[model samples]
Target: MRVENLHCSKRINPLVNFLIVALILSPSLTIILIPISFLLIMVYNVIRFKLLEPSVTRDTHEKFLQFIGGEPYYMDLDTYGKKGGTYADAVAIDAHNLYVLHEDNAVEIPWSMVRSWTIQAPGADRVVGVGMTAAMTAASHNIEAAAKAHEASGLFVFVADVNHPKWQFRTADTTILRKWNEILTQRNEGLLAA
Candidate 1:
């Protein structure tokens, strides 16, 4: 798929632009107009995102199918953190290779080249608390740490390639990460046995 076809341009609401112009001319109504402007922008953004989601998903699936001919054993569209001007990203597993669709291109990594894979939770040092009893502090810190980990967990795939040794796909949904990890482990074990 051509990368140029995936570029999307979002047009700002003309009413919002008009409202901003009004606010600039009528400075007396700044207090009332500011909140209304903010709310309208928020609503517009939510609606726009909801409408675009399905098309984005469909395009990602089509891209995957075009790139990987056979039916994928496992496919996930929620993967992220690949940043080479790609519109969407997904990870798929087949019998012989692991496929990553990103940057409007598909990359196939043979099972043998996958050295290791793991679901890495965010570090505990991300959250810090202050001015409490040691036990309370510890408890709060642990709770915050767990929450952060759950929110920012990612799957790390270590490949044998020298230039691109590690691939990280970040997602808040740990279930998918765990599932990928299990599938990869099984594939590695099977490769070893063969």
Candidate 2:
């Protein structure tokens, strides 16, 4: 399947984004920085794209079969979640359970155990966002482009077991976002294994 992968991580390399912001704020410097910035940005995005690329491994899939005892329909490793810094690979769901694989361990969470999944901005604090049209129109200096690029990128905090309410996985992958929307919606909740 085609992976949109890091919609935010691979968008514009941080340095290029910095340069763009710097130029936008100080337009006169573009006369000297423009050509150099363009070349640097092209190079940076290529390199960062390669480095930030996330993949699901053969071992991960094999292990899923062994432990979860089901064929994994989705898996990813450029994924990360924090239960106070625990998993790096995440949000894998099979027929009976959702598997969250940590750097050193894995948890098989039954579908029935899941209490809820919440979407929120990067930091613990949430910002009420403007609509796409308003966000774009207000971006006089394309500042909104930077903000909007990250609009869809946020942490998905889920409680796999209500008893362990303190236990949470905050996944920040674009694939996880899309998959959660598709597989865990109200319309699809009835389809989950009991």
Residue 174 local lDDT, model 1: 63
lDDT of 1 by residue, 1-194 (tens): 11122232233456765765576467686555655654564465456556655666677787677667878888887522121112455678877778765444456778778888878665555434453444445655675675466445667778888777776555656687788788777777775232
* Stretches of model 2 off by over 4 angstroms after superposition: 1-56, 79-88, 120-157, 160-171, 186-188, 192-194
Q: How badly does each model clash, as a count of residue pairs?
A: 0, 0
Q: Which predicted model would earn the best lDDT?
A: 1
Candidate 1 accuracy as lDDT: 0.61
Candidate RMSDs in Å, in order, are 8.5, 10.0
Candidate 2 backbone collisions, by pair: none
After aligning candidate 1 to the native by TM-score, how far in Å is the CA of 14 from where it should be? Answer: 13
Q: What is candidate 2's TM-score against the reference?
A: 0.42
Q: Which residue ranges in model 1 land beyond 4 Å of their true spot?
A: 1-29, 79-87, 103-105, 121-152, 191-194
Looking at model 2, which ten-residue stretch has the lowest summed lDDT? 1-10
lDDT of 2 by residue, 1-194 (tens): 11112112223344656766576467576444655554464465445545444423334445545665566765554433211221234456766666655443466766666666655434223234376544334432243344344443443435544444422233445555666666766424676553
